[model samples]
Target: MSFADLGLSDELLQAVEAAGYTEPTPIQAQAIPPVLMMKDLIGIAQTGTGKTASFVLPMIDILAHGRRRALMPRSLILEPTRELAAQVAENFEKYGKNHDLKMALLIGGVQMGDQIKALSEGVDVLIATPGRLMDLFERGKILLTGCELLVIDEADRMLDMGFIPDIESICAKLPTNRQTMLFSATMPPPIKKLSDKFLSNPKYIEVARPATTNINIVQYKVPVTARKKREMLRHLLRTDNVSTAIVFCNRKTTVRELAKSLKQHGFGAGEIHGDMDQSSRIGELDRFKAGEINILCASDVAARGLDVKGVSHVFNFDTPWHPDDYVHRVGRTGRGGARGRAFTFVTPEDAEAVQNVEKLTGGEIPLFEFSGEQPAEAAEAVEEKPKAQRPRRARKDEGAERAEAAPRQEAKEARSEEPRKERRPRRSQPEPVDDGWNGPVPEFLHVSALV
Candidate 1:
């Protein structure tokens, strides 16, 4: 169905059209109606299904009629990470442009001066990470009493990042009569309990099954040794006609190292992980979205937050440790019904990890066969420096040179040293007498008696 059928405002519809989305995604179509009706909601859909827009669009219209107050926002959206919080903020700006709505973003790793200013000036929509929100709430810089609508985006991610307790705390502060919504790709028991405790008779909308991979994504497992993962990734990148891709590594160090390795091998690549500062991470993402870099090596921090369009491929350089991460990592591609491919590098040790992923997705991923010998350049890329030393003839000549100097050294030593029998022994010192003090007499006391 078209976005018009979803009951969006005319100005919002116009903005959406300008943004180039004609029809609503399944999640958007299903969740928008309930949200506009001001009902609490529990939306479960896999990644890349327009979940952000589903809530952002309706909230703009619902909040348009509300008056904002100083130190209080009319609506609030809680995200798990700074990246996801920033992404949701972008959505609000994009879809809420035509409406008269003031928005503020609250996240860590950035100065709080601007956020405080925004809150003091009053904001209509506040998108924040739980940490930053709790910080401001505790400091009395922001109040949730004026908030008429609340959204908990990426609930499972919040659980993964240990934000559930903070979320519970934030919920306790907000007015109970206000509307609440929870969205996630997966619904674990904790999330279910959270919804039951907070939401009141909310409409449940699920576009896709939990932990399911996107059907638009063509997935394949490449069996390679840990040492050759980068090589296989490089090979696939060259042969598979990759346009824009995200390469996910399980560790932040691997993300940095892999990005550097790819750049050294003449690929336009950038790195983003939790270790990076917020500005640096945003800069890398901006570069990637602007096409200055075609490949982004990232940890799971970017798996859920990135919403760049036309991403043709996703390469899992390391199998995700958590099975849930596998869904989000590959979901970086095949976004918005676009056709995409996902290649996961599976080592012998990753058999169990890959098995868990398959089990979660409920299907066996076909093993991708290498057509021929490994790529020559790829192999060279990961090759260790040669261990061979200088030639044997040079070593032999050096040994002869040492042998010639040995006679001179022995003659010098004979001249410099006295014969062992003529050498005198070192003198032994006498022990001090115990004269009541049990030690040597003090020199100061031996000053001939200052008398």
Candidate 2:
């Protein structure tokens, strides 16, 4: 069904159409209706299934007439990461444009003075990360007592990042009568318990299985060593028909090093990680979305909540520490029903990690062979080939030495015969009998020194 059929405001529907979305996604189609009714909801869908809009669109229609007081927001959205919080805020700006609604984003790595000012003037919607929201609440810069709507996006990610306790505290502060919507890619025990404690008979809506990879993506795991990962990745980037891609590294340093290395190798690449400031991360992402860079080398946390369309590939430079992250990383591609490719680099040490990821996906990811030379076999065979050639040359040199030595023996025999003949001539009659014997023995007895 279209966004219009979901009971969205005409202004919001206009924005949706302007954004070129005619039909609602599965999560949006299912969860948007319940959310519009102000019912507590639990939306379970894989990443990149338009889950953010499922809540954001309906909330705009609900909050269009709400009265916001100073230092008090009418609605609050709790996101686990800065990227996700910023994305939700962007969604509000895009879809809630035709409607009159004030939304403020509270995330780290930004000036607090502006956030405080925005909170003091009051906002119709407050989209914030857990830590920043708590920080503002502690400073008495914002109040949630008047908040009528609460959205907890990426609840499983909250558990992964150790934000569960903070989420619980934030949930406790909000009015119990508020409408709440909880969305997660997976339903872990902690997320379930937290939902039971906070949500009031929520409508259970699941669009897909938990921890499942998108079927549109063709995924493969390559058996590669740490040293050859960069080489193999470069080969794939050059050989594959990639229009745009994300290379996911596990560490911030790896992201920096890989991006730098790719640039040095003449690839249009950029880097983003948790350690970077908010502006730098946003700049890189904007550049990537605009097609200024075809490849983005980023850490998993920084890559979260990025919704670039038509990413041709996703490369896992290093195996993730958690199996659930495998789903999230690959999900960056294959978005909005587009087909894509995902490649994961697996070393011997990463066997267990790859296995865990496969278990989560319910099968093994097919192996992808490099088109270039195989490292291990090529190294051994290349070494043996040179040694085999050396022996043949040595044998030929020995034969040449023997042939030269044979000619030297003939010269020595002639010299010895000359000495015997000279002695016989000088000794007159006494050397006459010995001369004949020496001449006959000369052919059979010969000693030669060869150098």
Highest-scoring model, TM-score: 1
lDDT of 2 by residue, 167-271 (tens): 989989999799999999999998999999999999999888899989999999877767778887888898888899999999999999999999999999998
The TM-score, computed over Cα atoms with residue i paired to residue i, of candidate 2 is: 0.83
Clashes of each: 0, 0
> lDDT of all the models against the reference?
0.90, 0.88
lDDT (tens digit, per residue) of candidate 1 on 303-358: 99898999999999999999999999999999888999999887768989999999
Pairs in clash, predicted candidate 2:
none
204 Cα displacement, candidate 2 (Å): 0.6
Q: Which stretches of candidate 2 lie over 4 Å from their true place?
A: 369-451
TM-score of each: 0.83, 0.83
Question: Which regions of candidate 1 deviate over 4 angstroms?
Answer: 372-451
The TM-score of predicted model 1 comes to 0.83
* Candidate 1 lDDT: 0.90
